[model samples]
Target: MLSLRVPLAVALLALGRARVVAQTTVKTVDLGYATYQTDASIVDGVTSFLGIRFAAPPTGDQRFRAPQPPATIYGIQNATVQPDECMQSAVGNATTPFRLSKRTAFVQNEDCLFINVHVPADLDLTSNASLPVIAWIHGGGYAGGSNGQNPAQTLVSNSNNTVISVQMQYRLGPFGFLAGETVAKDGVLNAGLLDQQFALQWVQDHISKFGGDPSQVTIYGESAGAGSVLQHIVAHGGNTQPPLFRAAMMDSPFLPFQYEYNDPMNEVIFANLSQMVGCPISNASLDCLRSVNASELNQMGQVIALDNLFGVFTFVPVVDGDLIVERPTVTLRKNQTNSDVTLIMTNSHEGDVFVDAAALVATNSTLAEYVANLFPRMNDSSIQQAVALYSNLTDVSAPTVPEQAAFVMGDSIFVCPAFYTLDAFPADSNWKGEFAIPPGTHGSELAYLFADAVPGLTFNNSAFISSFQSGFFSTAIALNPNTHGADDLKPDWPTFKQTGKTMLFNETTTGEPEVMTIPTSDALLERCAFWLSLSDVNAQ
Candidate 1:
């Protein structure tokens, strides 16, 4: 017979096991077709489920086509490792910022349509734990960047376990946005945008399993990602029934020249890409491109993009007549948008990263020359009008040619599009802000939000981080930045229509976070109005 002492010892070991479960236990979620398991250890009270496939790999014949639903998997899939990034075009040079180029080391592959989800470790999956959700789309000029670039563990933990975060990957560069009459006839245009929409639909279907409320999703993004938010806002002529998202937050939306699908320049870009990859331009060009090796094709895309103007992206979203409908400016002006609320932010200097100082100085380019290069479709008269509008500005931030170029590029591509979005929504439903930390250039605010994720950056201003996160997470959680329980350090923010005021997030001269509100600048609005008037000419 077994001794009483041995039985008592076994019982004691079982009683102490619960204390160590959080550190060693792996979490799993079932979604009918597949079961994904999260990381074993919980960090900062957040558990991450990474690299879950949302769509099937776009390869072979599927290349350049819209993303299709992922095939069913028989066994539990490991979601602990970050997914490989979609093939990216090399867009960095000596003058490129370190923040943008740091991702050169990320592994890339064609099978990269995965999504990552982060939720509180203590969330009860069996119970009715319908927490808020924030879906992030990263910015890489539509050419580079991965879903892993912005980790949401800190964001989920900072929300006091009240919100879940999701990030997705989409095809980039030529594979996603290749356009022309040939592509329109054979493949989908703006395939990357379709990938994003497919991921959002996936979120609607699967987020509830992760303890998130599908109806309370907030879409947030930066640069091209933010521009994507604008695209979705105007998607389907703003008639997305049973809407995918209720709110949106755009950080430095990059609205470059969106050419029509069959425009001469786009056709030329397609022909050049095909020729570079040995496909040549013909009826079978699409099939030839599909047959080429992935690396060879991606390298050709980079070559073609770098061969073009210095600071322009070659394969951005175009007016596809279906998903895109028309220029975003036209759609927004008609008050046709899907999102119910908007929070838009711009950096103090958005153009610095895009413009090369040596190129501006070496060419001795005039404003008209720079503007012409940026928008090749604009006629000579319109170029001169743009030059005239910006040439003699008393409020020019700096007098140097580089500064002038930055101002012009920033306004046309980044800043002014923000104003268009702001003016599109009802004042009560919209809010705007400027991230003005000294020399507040493009992507600088990202460090403040994801300090640990961004490399080679150190932010010690706890107060500012607290204030900024409160406003952003508050908006995602409650649809208002000034919601109760948000950081008290932040001032009473006002809607854009209520006061026409822009909240400025800055640091005092002594290096402490300072939050204040100021009326929208009349001078800036004047310049934006001039740019908007030329939308038809610039293909905006």
Candidate 2:
């Protein structure tokens, strides 16, 4: 007899069992996931639970296959503590100055297919009601990141309606990606995307028990996360929002696979990087590589080619026509999506963080050296223009040469991606385009959205709080996007028509949402437009 056992206190509160006791603060709970269940402690500030398994391990025979659903359990699983972070390459080591934030950047492992959930402290798991939920996907070029990286306690606490913040982990690198032939038979080769879809399904089936309004969910992310969120909409025939999420926020979204797929430039990157980490695929010795330890594979993240040769990134989610229906750009241009859900398109400075001199100094010492660091076969004259444009964007009072490089990084990567995504929107879309200003870098808006990181980073609370609330309101709009959150601050922002509507987020001055083809700060899109028209020009 498999008699399931639940905690005495929790059992009393279960549907079948009943007990009454003092209402004490609970910092943790058990979420008995299939396979093996464990206790994950909650956080002090809010109702938080760590190490909630979202999917079964994608290891052993399960490698590269679409993730299997977590098994069901009759007993309660203790979710009182968070598991370690997911397996990933260490970007900046603990000693690195940029890695000094209080956040824990370590504690990773291969069996990291779990997610963390944080909600308001007063959340009543015993209630028969449901609250709106938000799922967060972290961005790391799809190479490094975990559910533990971002906490949703603040967002959930701030939300007027009940909200749940979830951060889930997916496989990375050769194990998660490594697209070729065998994998495509399953579908459009992007297995990582499938991992995400599965997690959303888990949310739909199980979130109600956790006090989440399954029908009012919102999928949100930044950078690669933004790309994942967008992929859900235009891919497969199903919508992640209709049944899964009613709203979505795509920030600094990028489509790396659309830009390049198995090109010589990136092959060199892979080959060279593999060599640096002692895994070069010489003499068809990939068999040994396949059996290599997962930890070793992650350590190789250090060798990833930094060469921006063809102005492309490697190992991103692809539009395999299976997982992702079509390229995000094409879908937006065609407006072949559910316009019922409101979409928020956001971007930031192209250069600030990437151009950080510390990274340059860490990687190389001189400008000429950095240029040479770029892949050797580089013939794109755009490289010269890219460098010049970066320098021109900065002021003579710039702190250092590297400080100016941030602008170049911003323009080439983030700014362009944001511009391309918004511009691709047809007059047929319910999409509204907005860009963060001034010192906006990749994760800067996080400072505003998260209160703890705000004052420390010199972020304006007043402007940010309103903006954050506006985001919540806009998420509501995703269900019916045209609905305004605060008419005083944002009076029904208009969707674009080859022209973007700008809504500046400033703390000191009163600003209003306005319409335009582009912000005054935006560089015209004439050239990038014509070039992008030839997106499929060369297959490499």
Candidate 3:
């Protein structure tokens, strides 16, 4: 991590936390274990309960391992006081407004596996109708982030039908993605995914208490969360073995989970453990690490010299073979999906916010410095090509560079991965692809979907935008997986073809879909296609 001492940044004292689902009126339910009451009057007429912990704290010996299932209390406990978030540093510098609650999410703790549920107040959870369930996993590159995201009161209120929207928090950073002989030999690659799987299992067992139909579950998420969704779908074969969710929607998902970013050069992931207890790599001792104090782990994470390396959560998801099987595309293509998992994969205009030149754009490179940057990453040639292409794209002043390169950055990392994922699926297979050009970046859809998109449009044209989203998604999900209904989410829209007919999600063109003509729209991208090809070829 950092030089063993954590630096304390200017910690802003903030309060006025957004109320979870505006105060509302709805009958509460007692699971005998806990009493979860509903707060209606949320912005979108939905009722929600905040801070529901799904599992016991993974402290002490349970450190750096799969989450243990939560125990049910003997009596009704007040389901309030949202669980403190998992250990994750906040991205205050992010162009998007994802908050700086705890620059490193001080809310984090060993006891961090929890789920927050929101539902339309209009429909009671105890009601008999089969309302759809949307289980969302938060995104922080498998490193940091919480279940209490932009919030889903709006979606629950506006959908006009009952929906159980649950957002969850999981272990992050070294705690979540730490991979080595100790972790691998113990049979866990992405222990974070293990937390997600258990959350789904929690839903199947307890959602009904909140009036959620486990059979009508739809797992959806953006960025890393979306990647986790796809991973779950392909990991255990559509959850059919036990059957957690029936459908899935992945938005700008991390389609392929890679490993180069975690080991050796970034050896800091487990440095604290080594300094305090765990034997070094030569020893492969996890038991030593397991006995270390949890607070010490938290302190170690905060001090980690990530900016020195590259941003927060350095120990991101890796191809460790246990939690993750293979690159997302490879796994799906090889082991056909047996369950009807409705697919809605998407991307945005600017997904890779940090792709800016000031960050890692290579220029006037020393060969050693260059090699050090992309060390051990398969082909050495592709590193230079990536640097050259990145340098060129960053040079927006050049007329030769198309304006669309802004979106292309996201495409290569986020959107392009989804494209590769869809292409891997059999043609004529159920799938939908769309892109949102709203004035925003990564997780920009959060405000539109959960919080407010355009502040001025509140109470006026809000219905139109809300209806558009509901119409589009309802239609796509129903038809894509043939999910027991013939209803369309919106008007005439074209299903994505091998040629990549992308649906445009904008102010004027909500449902009307169109094609992104790469031949003309992306002619300049050729400058980097060669590099990309080499990168892939070199990987193979």
**Candidate with maximal TM-score:** 1
Q: Candidate 1 vs candidate 3: which has greater lDDT?
A: 1
Which stretches of model 1 miss by more than 4 angstroms? 1-24, 40-43, 92-104, 455-459, 484-487
Query: What would the TM-score be for candidate 1 when compared with the true structure?
Result: 0.92
Which candidate number would show the highest lDDT if scored against the true structure? 1
lDDT of 1 by residue, 190-230 (tens): 99999999999999999999999999999999999999999
Weakest ten-residue segment in model 3 by summed lDDT: 1-10
Number of clashing pairs, model 2? 35
TM-scores, all models, native as reference: 0.92, 0.74, 0.77
The true-versus-predicted C-alpha distance at residue 431 of model 3, in Å, is: 4.5
Q: Which prediction has more favorable lDDT, 1 or 2?
A: 1
Output the TM-score of candidate 3.
0.77
